[model samples]
Target: MVMITASGKGTSSTKGTNSTKVASSTSGTNSTKKASGTWSPPEFDESLPREVTVMEGEPAELPCVVFKLKGRAVSWIRQRDLHVISANGLTFTSDERFKVTLDNATSSFTLGVAEALRNDSGVYECQVNTRPKLSRPVSLKVLVPAARIAGATELFIRRGSTLVITCTAQLHPTAPSKVEWVHNSSVVSISGGRGGVSVHTERGGPQLSSTLSLAKVEMRDAGNYTCRPHSLTPASVTVFIVDDEVPAAMHHDSGVGRGGGCPLPALFYSALAALTCPALCPALCPALTCPVPPYPAPS
Candidate 1:
């Protein structure tokens, strides 16, 4: 017959049942924890944009994109000093030219720089704030209108000569580009800054003019000269110099009169006699052969 056990006698049976339930519950909790831990969140792809070119004094746009982004932040940094230019859809500093525009769906960010300067030429980096932090680097080169001398040219000066050459070119933004004299393509004799040279900018559109001068001429200074304009093409020209002395013989001859070598009357008579001989010799045939006067020899 089925009978209910008393509390003290049933203690061992209840204890065993409770222990089995506790073991099962502990195993279920451990399995659930492991499942949750195994699932990983999607990561952001931090990659910099490609194919970017900009001109000097013009606006530049740099694009940075983050793909598969879940909960990560994006940042833009200049490579020079790892300076943070922009971050997380917000500009940290109040620089008027720096702006960030984002395309939420495409996960792309664009950094705009207005009126780019020479200092803006460098590498830009894109970063994603995720585990291990994904990053990509891009290079930006700013091009200004420039001209340089073709390698086929050179400059020269003769001994005891003057050094004179012209370096000419055109530039953008209506400012004069620097013109420098490069010797052997290394030694910088004159540049835009202070020294024995100077640079002057005339108000004209994209056109630059400059001249290089050697104040005191020397004999040893004769050689090839190159005119290189700063950030522009180069032009080269040759120079020649000579000593000021005149030859002594040339001076002596200068004093002689045009007819000094022979008298005019003597010259006329000699011409007349020569003409008469051809005709008279035929007529004076036989014993009357004309005794030709030894025509007065040309004085």
Candidate 2:
């Protein structure tokens, strides 16, 4: 006599919906043939794995094994709505994300799920039709990963300052396979920074973090920087570089006063906001009470 075992799987196509729950069961029935002494019903093992965990959008496998099935059917069914997904290695639903494979050498039936969704989380059953029937239950759990930046979403820094960005992935099973930084939608070379660019990563519990550091940053670095992980959604931050040039409103006694090459005269006008005569506003006069400080006299 030959036994059989099979697993059931559900695929997920959407973020919050798990399309299939892969469930697996093993059979304990003995493959020994007697001289017509007695007939034993198919034995189902309940000690098999009852819980399976997988990341969303990834494939999941469920296995069901039946020993000494001896011309019996192995099938998988959803416990929530009692929907039969596969029967005797044949698919019952039109969902192409699911498929069953039966191996004669191992007497094992396996279910495969592709692109798993969040809604596919549920209990699945592997069943062997017999006199009273036999069943094994397994639970499917889906995990979703989220990405974030440790510092502010937007950043402002002076030129020549060191730049550090930390990207953290929460609820991830492991660290991202690849982490890269992008500037203004273009890939930033890890080795192309002024003071050199370096990346370091650490894992703590279920959270994984990677830090990108650029030394002696410059104005060209000012732009939208994005932290992209292969598995999670990318996070972005805007970088603004403060200029080193002084504002023109402040000038020394070199006659380079408000009206003398003072590019930002608006600073004076803004100070005399209460002046009704905009053209004759004394605020524009360098000797007058200007809003901005006058440049220091030559030593």
Candidate 3:
């Protein structure tokens, strides 16, 4: 007599011949085959941008795109402090400036920061829930807008000469909205017959220039000139309109008093006269003898 025993279902023991019958069932199937029929694993889209840039005080957005996301959750973490900023379209940070948004059409999770500051620039991670926890790093750069005049803080332009001053505004990743010129606390105009004054602007990349031109600079044009970039700190330069004809008897070289032995600092004779002399130093600049060197034409 011959006997055999089968342990589990889908297995049959036969006593008649040297043969056994087995039935294939799902319970005995491979795990990979079972998973193949379920939802696909989440994968990050490599074609999307891996870095973001924005100007200070502007809104900044970083995107995280995934393929076959299914029910997986997406999160944004600030790498600077390893702080969780948002997860699954919900913000976890206390700061009201940070927010998360989800787009079902493109399977994207975006983190937005309003009024972005320089301190907000850093690496951020886009995380997706998975067995191993998949993540992608994205870099953020924030630039502060800086506006400045091209020349020195103080300038002297000879009367009847063309005065060309340029103000350059820089805001990396973006451009300044507007640039304006102010003369002696009054706004300068490019048109309306405003004393031959004109303004020209040009932009390239992150930097732009605004040129203020005066056809024939006169005494009236001498004063404080300010360049104001919209929503940015304004820069000012002291301007002096000097006469082309210098006094024959007076020689101003290193303050070596030649006209009447009037001893004055060399700074008084320099282009910085509007800053250090005439009004501020009346003792050194006598009205009759020293003659307060004809620097800025009398207002």
Pick by lDDT: which candidate is best? 3
Sorted by lDDT (best first), the order is 3, 2, 1
Q: What digit string (tens of lDDT, one per residue) describes model 3 on residues 156-238?
A: 55688888888988755554458889999789997746578889988888787888899887778888888888777788887
TM-score of each: 0.43, 0.48, 0.59
lDDT of 1 by residue, 1-299 (tens): 22445664587778888999999999999999999778454343434455466668778888776766665788988889988988878886676887889888888878888877767888887787767767777777777655543322323223444455555565666454556665444444554332444334343566666655664555434445666666565655433232333222112222212333422222232235455552333233221212123333344
Better of 2 and 3 by TM-score: 3
Off by over 4 Å in 2: 1-41, 45-48, 54-58, 68-71, 104-106, 114-119, 141-163, 168-178, 183-197, 200-209, 215-225, 230-232, 236-299
Candidate number of the best TM-score: 3
Candidate 3 vs. true structure, TM-score: 0.59
Prediction 3 global C-alpha lDDT:
0.74
Tens digits of per-residue lDDT, candidate 2, 223-259, equal 7888887767888877655444323433332223445
Model 2 residue 97 CA deviation in Å: 2.8
lDDT of each: 0.57, 0.67, 0.74
Which residue runs of candidate 1 sit more than 4 Å off their true CA positions?
1-51, 152-299
**Lowest-scoring 10 consecutive residues by lDDT in candidate 2?**
19-28
Model 2 gets an lDDT of 0.67
